[model samples]
Target: MRELDVAKLPEYVEEDVRVSEWSTVRVKHCAYSVPSRLKGKWVRVRIFEDKIEVRFADVIELACERLIGRNLCRIDYRHVIWSLIRKPGGFARYVYREEMFPSLVFREAYDGIQVLQAGTKGDLEYLRILHLAASTMEADVAVALSLLQMAGKAITSDAVKEMIASSSTSIDVPQLVSPAVRLSEYDALLTEVAA
Candidate 1:
């Protein structure tokens, strides 16, 4: 058997992709979301086995599980939640709306909001909740939703936010104590030197 040179092998393929207006880039015929702030910017996409990593200005922005088939989309709701909060009306027509629901709890929360409110109001409320999940701890949001669901209360965004806030524990700061300095130690050292 012959030995192969390490430098002759290519680790991955790089492609320069322009992030679309929707905050996504096309790679392997599929769309993947980048950070919303990175829209209208060029990103270097590194295609690796089992994942596709997107980088902007040498900093890794995000990585997605590469899709095997064509025309598929992988979206993280957190990546675009802020824009959706500003324009809730766009949810209905958003191409990747289905991917926004990260879990069943979030889906159920959105459904509950829709049942309680009407039209764009419900969408806005759900977007706010999603935004909260994106901004804060998602596990905390899930716990809050669970509590709200058990209480048979409306799962509005404000309710979820309050529940999360109330459930969080406040940290106590400890007072600093300065150690006393003894001048006698220095005097003893001077006396020993003089002797």
Candidate 2:
């Protein structure tokens, strides 16, 4: 038993990979997205059984669930939203376009926006909403979109932003005032106990 190595072996396989211009790394025939800032940079990928950790400059940058099948992709919209916002036309033909929608509400909002403004204009508006979601809290944006849809209001990024701002402003939290603690009462109790 002493001859056996006491140190534990790493369960993950490590590899060095370069981030593509699209901010993705191909691992085991699956594409996993990294942050846009890591584009064209070499990163260390530690592939575990269930997840993969991407590291740059010895610091962990991204951790994604490992894809099981070939030609599969795990694309995070936040990683690519900036470029898509710049070129809204590319959204129509984006290979992983469906992955761009963070949730059903976002998809519905896009459809609604398309109904209001067709072609590239709708795309731009939807991209702006997505950008808002990526930058701000997604749940907040989703709630704003849901509220706008419920009210039968036109769903635009600006409308969602306005809704969010108004809702945030309207929140009323009751102030809690803690009662002053009395040390004299405790002293009296002690005196009574002594007597």
lDDT of 1 by residue, 157-193 (tens): 8888888877775556789999999999999999999
Off by over 4 Å in 1: 1-9, 170-195
Q: What's the true lDDT of residue 30 in model 2?
A: 97
Write out the backbone clash pairs for model 1: none
Number of backbone-clashing residue pairs for each candidate, in the order shown: 0, 0
Best candidate (score: lDDT): 2
Candidate 2, residues 1-195: lDDT per residue as tens digits? 568668987899999999998889999899988889898999999999999999999999889789999999999999999888989998889888999998999899999999999989999999999999899889999999998899999988888888888878899999999999999999999999999
Models 1 onward score TM values of: 0.81, 0.86
* Candidate 2 global CA lDDT score: 0.92
